[model samples]
Target: MNTGKAHKSGLRVVASHSSLWGRFLQGDRHAFAEIYEAHIDDLFHYGMHFCQEKERVKDCLQDLFQDLWSSRAHLSPNVLHIRYYLLSSLRRRLLRALRKDRRYQHRESWEAFEFEYTLPQENQLIINETIAEQKRLLHKALSSLTRRQREAIYLRFFQNLRYDEVAEIMSMQVDSVYNTISKAIGLLKKQLPLPLLLLLLGK
Candidate 1:
């Protein structure tokens, strides 16, 4: 299967939950599978951003989907996007997992977590060759940030999360979340050219 095309089509299908929910509730297993395929990568990536450990992220995801499947009859698909719901659920599960594992708790310092995007090696090399200078500057500026600042920026820009959601995920007060993100932007401004800074801000 063309997984990317299938995933996009699944999201389009899921746009109207009332209709899709009806189909799913009426014993359409394919509908559920489509929902799963569309969201698994997003869930995995989001979980990894917070949890860092691959095994923990995988476990959290498995537990989340297992819970969802077990409680499928009670789910209110009309009230929420499954993607957002799963992310929120997985975040909670990760927190619980951290609490249970002392090693994970110790590693909870945001700086210890690294965010990586895995592109095809050839494409990554090509892109790097094309934008080497800009990439270096961007990386330098990013590396200068504290973990909280980096998380705030990534959640706000990369994940398109609202300040409230970022605060919730980061376990900070909403005002604090705003302050962290603002400070991060200020620091980036000092390191980046005006045009590049503007582009980042525009995002």
Candidate 2:
């Protein structure tokens, strides 16, 4: 697995983002803009998953960046992943905004992470019936998971966050995050072949 190479790569990522964060905190306009460019799409993606309203997501993102710039002087310099920091900020903003709006009163908590699998036209035609059925089963199993379970999976796999980062973002204990992901994976394993399951889960 080339553990040494992997460790070096991880350190590189931390150094890159940590340096950028420091620059931004020092009031570097270019660094601030670069951070926005790198994370805006991912923030928006996570926002949409948390709340389906596109306009709301855009509004929250705009506000988030605006606030970041305004408050940069007081911001902490310890951010390792700008993506993770921005995601956590956007999440808080969305939840607060949703709570204030009377229309969203029915949503007592964050809903399950929602997603659909899609294939390109050429690839779709080549997918046999067996594979199609397996896809259906996978989707069904995903839907059956609790909101927290689905969210843990999304942040762990789709967002590619470390388990500890996911725990912090979700306000869960590290042990709880491990258990949640383990349970979710166990359930998914029952629905598909091991080879296909690993591929679908982005393992």
Q: Among these predicted structures, which one has the highest TM-score?
A: 2
TM-score of 2: 0.78
| lDDT for each residue of candidate 2 in 1-203, tens digit (9 for 90 to 100) | 23223322342343544578888899999999898888878788888888889999999999999999999878878777777888888889998999899998876344548757664455446555556776777678767777888888788778878777888999999778778877777776675667466445442
> Candidate 1: global Cα-lDDT?
0.67
Best by lDDT: 2
Models, CA RMSD each: 8.7, 5.0
Pairs of residues clashing in candidate 1: none
TM per candidate comes to 0.67, 0.78
Lowest summed lDDT across 10 adjacent residues in model 1 is found at 1-10
Model 1 CA deviation exceeding 4 Å by range: 1-18, 25-27, 108-137, 193-203
Per-residue lDDT over 39-76 for candidate 1, one digit per residue giving the tens place of the 0 to 100 score:
89877877776767789889888888778777778877
